[model samples]
Each structure stands twice: as C-alpha cells, then as structure tokens.
Target: MNLPKRNSEDGRYYLMTPDAREKLQPLFDRCIRDAIDGKITRPDSLYPPVVVSSEGAPFGVHYLAMDWAEAQRAETFNVEQAVAFSENLRRLSRWGEIDHYLLGVLERELQKKYFVVTGREDDHRWNREYSLKPGIRAEDVPEPLLRFACYVAVSYKVYGLDFQYLDTNYLLGLVEKVRPNMVKKLKENGTGRLPLNLQKRKKEHFTASANDAFAVIRISAKDCTEECYSEVLNYLCELLSQEDFPRSYAVEFKGPEKKYLSITGLPKKGINQLCACAVQYPSLQSLLERYARLAMRQYERYTNLDDEQCALPGSFAVFALGMLGQPWRQLVWDYLGLCDDEHSRLQEKFLREYVKQFGFTADTVPIFVRGVLSMQSMKYSKDYAAWMANAESLGALLDAKARLSEIVPSGFSSDDDDEDDEPTDETEAGPEEVLQYAWETVCYVIWGKASAKRGLKVVETAPEELKERYRQIFE
Candidate 1:
C-alpha cells in the first residue's frame, strides 16, 4: 500500500485508512491505545514519549502534497542513506519544508536506509523500488511516521513558554558597558535635548529605564556591524524621540574584532519634559476606564457568539464579573438563558462560583437554580448530580433571604477540608478525576435552590422529567 494515504478530504494530520486501521487494530488494541490515551491525560505543556511497537518496524516516507499549506521547515534533511536520497532532496527542495532538528532526531532513531516518496511526480524505476519497505505488509506503512503523526495530532496542547523574563543585573551590566561611549559621543556632539545630559539628573533613571532602553539597544546590537558607530548614535537619538524612554542613554563602543571597547552615557531633559506633559493630562485613569468599557463590550460579544465549540464565553463572562469586577448584572442574567447544553454546563459552574464569590444573595438564587438545573439532559455523572443537590440548597437559602454564613457548617471552609493531602499515584487517571472534582466543587453551588425545590439530594441522579425537558430543548 502507498505510504501516507490521504484518508480524509480535509486533514493536516496523517491518516490511517480502514485497511491500515484493521491491519494495525490488534497492535493498537493490545498495546498502544491504553498507553497513549493514558499519556494524553498529562498537561499540554509536556510532550508524551513517542511509541513504537517493535524494533524492526519499517520506516515510512511522507511527501508534502501540493494542496497542503506551504510548510516552512525550521531545518534541512541531509540524505546519507540512499542514491534516491539525492533525487528526494531535489524533489523536497521544491516541495517540503523540513524541521532539521526534529528530522535529525527522527533520522537517528529510524536509521534511514531507504528513501521513498509517497506521492508521484516521477515514474522513475528507483522510485518504485523504495516505495514499500521489504518484509512490511501491504496494508502497513513505516512505524516511525505513524508515531510521529500521532504526536503531531496532539502537539497543539503545548503551552508557549514565556521568554520575556530578563535579569536586572544582566541588563544593568549592558548599561554599564554602553554608558561611557555615550559620554564620549556627548563631548563630540552635545545638545540640551539629547539623552547624554539626562543621566546627570538622576542615577536611578539609568536603572529605571534600562529595560525599555535595552529593548532598543538589543536591536541595535544585532544590526551593528564592524564599523557602525553612526548607526549606534541614530538608535540613541531614536530612543530620545520616544516619550517612554527615561533621561539617560548608553552606547557600547566596539574595538577591532568587534570586541567591547568601553561604554559611555548621555543625558538630556527628556524626563523633565515627560513630567511636564504628565501634569497637563491625567490620561492613565481615563484610558483604564475606557479600556474597561471596551473589554466589557468585547466580553458581551464573546458571550453572544456560538461559533466556538468550547465554553469559553461562559468562562469569559464569569472572569469579567469576577476578576474585573464588572457591574453587568443583565449580561450575567442573559448568559443564564443562553446556557442549555452539557458543554456550557462547565462554564455555568464557573459563573456560579463567581456569583457566590461576589456575594450574590437570595435575589440571584432563581438565576442560579434555573441555569444549572436546565442541564439535566446532559450525561453528567452521578457525583455531579450529588454536587448539584447541595448547591440547590444554598440557592434556596438565598431565595428565602437566609444568611449563608450561618447556614454553612463550621470547618467546611477550613484548610483541613483539603483532600489533596496524599500525592497522586496514577500517571493516567484520565480526565474524569478533574471533571468529577469540578462537578463536586463548582457545579454543586448552582444546584442548591433546585435541590430544595425538588426535595431531593442534589447528588442524586436526575429525574425522568428533567431528562425529558432536555430532550424537548434539543428537539
């Protein structure tokens, strides 16, 4: 069979066809599925270990299709395995974008001995010879490609690492290196408005402004050549023109091999003018107020849209009200009417937490009760039902103007109530442990009033009428 057969009409992922699926079904069912599925439970920030069934598993080649988005590979493939490798290189140079790092790792593990192109652009005899690896089944492709593709499918879970944390001492050292050069330049070309004179105003100004100044300086460093002193001066002048930069600027002088010669400082009246401008307008408070209003409107738009599959809108609404302290009571009420499905229930639970946190009393009990109870059609676990029962009672107290502080049992909110005293032993508990915990904590709050109204434990399984109501909504 051809390697990397296009199984789906629209897919970025490598496909496993029905024939290939059946051929590999025993291996998947007996060995791979449980192991990989367990690994999938880990947080998205980590990459799961790659899996290969056997040591002698064949290598599969995947060619870039013309219809696919032009891939920008971060690295190149050096073909040291086959004569066809040279042609493969010629073809890939026109088609494939390779990640050299990932490819290098894969190459070592796979130990490339043949080069095969999955698709046809040439009918050369050498192409057919490498199309299928010897001793491999007609239904099977190479094991390495399959493993790589599976990893690619779930790679979206990886979180972007923050790279913006720069050490203060390291930054100041750069400033120390650059300051002396600026002073020398100042003597050669002094001006009242230049940053060369600004350093004399305050020593703290240099340290205070180094971070912003470094951002500009780093760009100049990268662009600086063997003889770019004039470029450095231009960068310093540009920093002076920006309102955000402080009173001082520094430049690092370069010696003959582009070695560091010295650092010089320049001072100007930039900070004084900045202070004068601050007095003319109190824009920070005004701008913050304006931004808050804009954020609220944007959140409103997010809540109203149904295009996204996730319950992000409900979370956004809760976050807006909880974190930003938005006074959008009507928006929260409107959000209640919109949440009617299993997926939205999670967001509704988050909203309930925000509602209770902000001390929404009996006046808001009806909203919580109706919103949470409306998801009865969803396949929420029995534990979730139990949580809903307890939550309903709290809402009932709010409805009857009862004091929650008096009703909540003593020690329930105490630190000793934590259940995470024991370390988690299972590496692959699936996501159920998290879901059950969410239901018990957040969802339990919203169902409190509904529990009292029905005279049933919130944790009890849903009654038939509730299920029917859910069906009716969908119908």
Candidate 2:
C-alpha cells in the first residue's frame, strides 16, 4: 500500500493515500466491531475524558470520523485519545473477554512501537504512571529484564501468550538473535576478554605450593661487631623452624662449616627481584633497609675471615594451602593461638579501643579483630624492621616529652592559652613543608641523624622549668 509522505516542513500531518487507507480499512473495521460488541475497555477507567478541541462533539459514526481525521493530522495518538477509543468500544459491547482481547490489543500495539515486552502487566501500569521514557528499540530494555525473560523462557518453555506451543527452537532463536549484538557492543566498549589475565593470575597465585623463600637482608657497619653474622644466622634458623612457617622452606647458617640443609621442595625460580612472595607484610621498605644495614655490618666485621664465614643467606616461604579458603576469624585464632577466655577478652578490648579511635560502631567484633591481627602480622614480619626502628624512635621522643611535662610544674604565666595551643605559624606552611618537618623530626629521634640542620628554630618555646626538665630527661 502507498502511504502518504510525511510533511517535512510542519512534521504533523501525513495524508492517507487511497491504497493505504484501503489496506488499513479491514483492521479499523475489526477494531470498531470489537469495540461496538463490548470486547474492549480503557486500561485506566478512572481517568477523566479529554476535552474536545471543537465544540459539541458527536458520538458514533461522527466521533469515529473526527478521531480518524485527528489521528491523520496529529504527530501521534495521545494517551487520552487511546483511552477514550478503548472506553467507547467497551461501552458499545464490542469486546467479549476483558482479560484476553483487551490486554492482547495493548500488547500488540506496544510491540509495534518497538517495546521489549515484559512478563508483567503490573510493570506496564507502573511505567504509564511514571511516564517512563519510550524505548527506541527492543534491546533498549534493561539487561536485568532481558535476563529475566531468558530465564522464564528456559524454565517454563513459554514465549509470551504462546505458552502452550513449546519448542526448543524458540529459546535458541532468542539467544541467537541477541548474542551477536550483545557481543558486538561488548567488543566495541573494550570489555570483552579484559579480565581473563587478572583472573588467571589470581587463580595461579592462590593455588600454587609454597616452596620459594622471600628474604630481605639489611647490612650496616654497626652490625659487624661480635660475631653478629653468626647471631643473625641463628635467628634465621629459628624463624624457619617455626611450625606455622612453610616446612618446605629453609635457611642455612653457612658459618665456618660451609654446610647447607635441604628443604623438602624448592621453587623453580631463584631469588630475584621479579619473584613475588605471596606473603603480605607491612613496612617492606623499612624491613629491606634493616636487612641491608645488617648485611653490610656483617661484611665489614668478617673482612679478615674466609668468604664462607661472612656470607649468610636466609629465606622463608608462605603457604597458599587453605589461605583463601579459611575464614579470617579462624586464621586469627590459629595465628594467635588464643585460649578460649583470652579470645573473649581480646575481642572485647579490641572492640572498645577500635570504637574510641575510629569513631564507628561495627555489627561484628571479628572484623575489627581480624584487622588488628593483620596489622600485627605485618609489623612482626622480617619486611618491617626499618619501620619498627623509626616507630621506636618517635615513641621514645614522645615519651621523653611526656616525662618532661610530668616532672615540671606549670609556672604562673600570663599566656593561659599556651596550655592547649599549637604553633599557629605551622597552619600557614604548605604540605611539602609539613611533610619535610615530620620526616626530619622522625629521623632525628629514631636514627639520631637529620638530613638538614634547618628549621630547628621552629620548636615551640617553653618555660625555663620545662626546658630544664626536658634536658634532665634526655641526659
């Protein structure tokens, strides 16, 4: 049928050609007869009728003609017009079955408008209420809804109202129709096959046996005195023998005897920079620093001795077995070896301290306890020796200051605000300046060394009694 060309200029009306009108006549007649027979009804019967543009609108033949003309001239048929038509048909006794015929017509019209049909008429009602944006195409329906449709099709062997005509090809056809477009979109967005490598790595890292030892050694001039290398070797041996550590990993003393003990298994990869030890530890940088210092001191001390006596290697492996499968609570309990009563007390004390420090209540105490245990594990690892040293220095400095405050009595001074006040000048300092000050202060107290002598004048002024007390504590 030759349909009238849409008017490009105004975009409102399209004249119905003779051929197109003839083609549409049968559908229109069927709808009209159905309406007159009370086979159709308005979906929303409570809504008020729309006001006619012209005065004294007629019913029956005249009304139908007016509506036909309006539909032809208008950009689209509005909700009010659709509802009025349905209601008029119902009143005329055109519809036989309210649920079957009326709902079927609505569904047909929605499909023609390119809506992906949902299994729910309730959803349709909600969409109308919310005035949801029209879907431009079938796939514009949400992914969850599409998946739900697929699931229903698979489980019930049904396709919409044609549920009785079960066919395997119907479900296969749906999948075939949607798959290509979905895959194309995924590829275009660079998401297809994106996570494969990450997933594989995680699987391998979690499943592999722990035969490799990850070691961090520190060397310094001070550690070389009094057979310090022998002592370090002894410590390494003890660490390897611990029941919790991987039995397959071993460390050798190699001192004077040039002998080595064989562990049950060893990883194919040798000790190298690229080898990733699966063990999680805190303050790795500090640990490495301490190892380097100790190593250097050993080298300096045993310079006169044979190479075998001075060179000491240590390693410890972490096992992957049950690592991922174990609950965090069980892991903590096993690691700490806490007795039943001690565990309860630990949980209570941890909860109280955590709430006070972090200012949040938790639903479970286990999560906070796990976090504390994790932190402790990291701190005690060989990797965190440097961090421990620095932390120790800071702790000592604070302790000294606290002792000084305790020993010295406050003098009767005019500056009452001094008791609680901070140095106001620091507020003006940039982040870099603040960071530099912190770093220097930490180094000075911990390592008894400072990179720069500058900024010492910024120290807060105290009363003569306080100053004397601080000096006495240091001395």
| Off by more than 4 A, model 2 | 1-113, 116-120, 123-190, 193-196, 202-204, 207-351, 354-475
The top-ranked prediction according to TM-score is 1
Candidate 2, residue 420: how far the Cα is off, in Å: 35
Q: Per-residue lDDT tens digits of candidate 1, residues 313-335?
A: 22332333322334445445445
Candidate 2 least-lDDT 10 residues = 296-305
- Give each model a TM-score: 0.23, 0.16
**Residue 210 in model 2: lDDT:** 20
lDDT of 2 by residue, 124-183 (tens): 332322112364434543343233223323222211223322322332233334444642
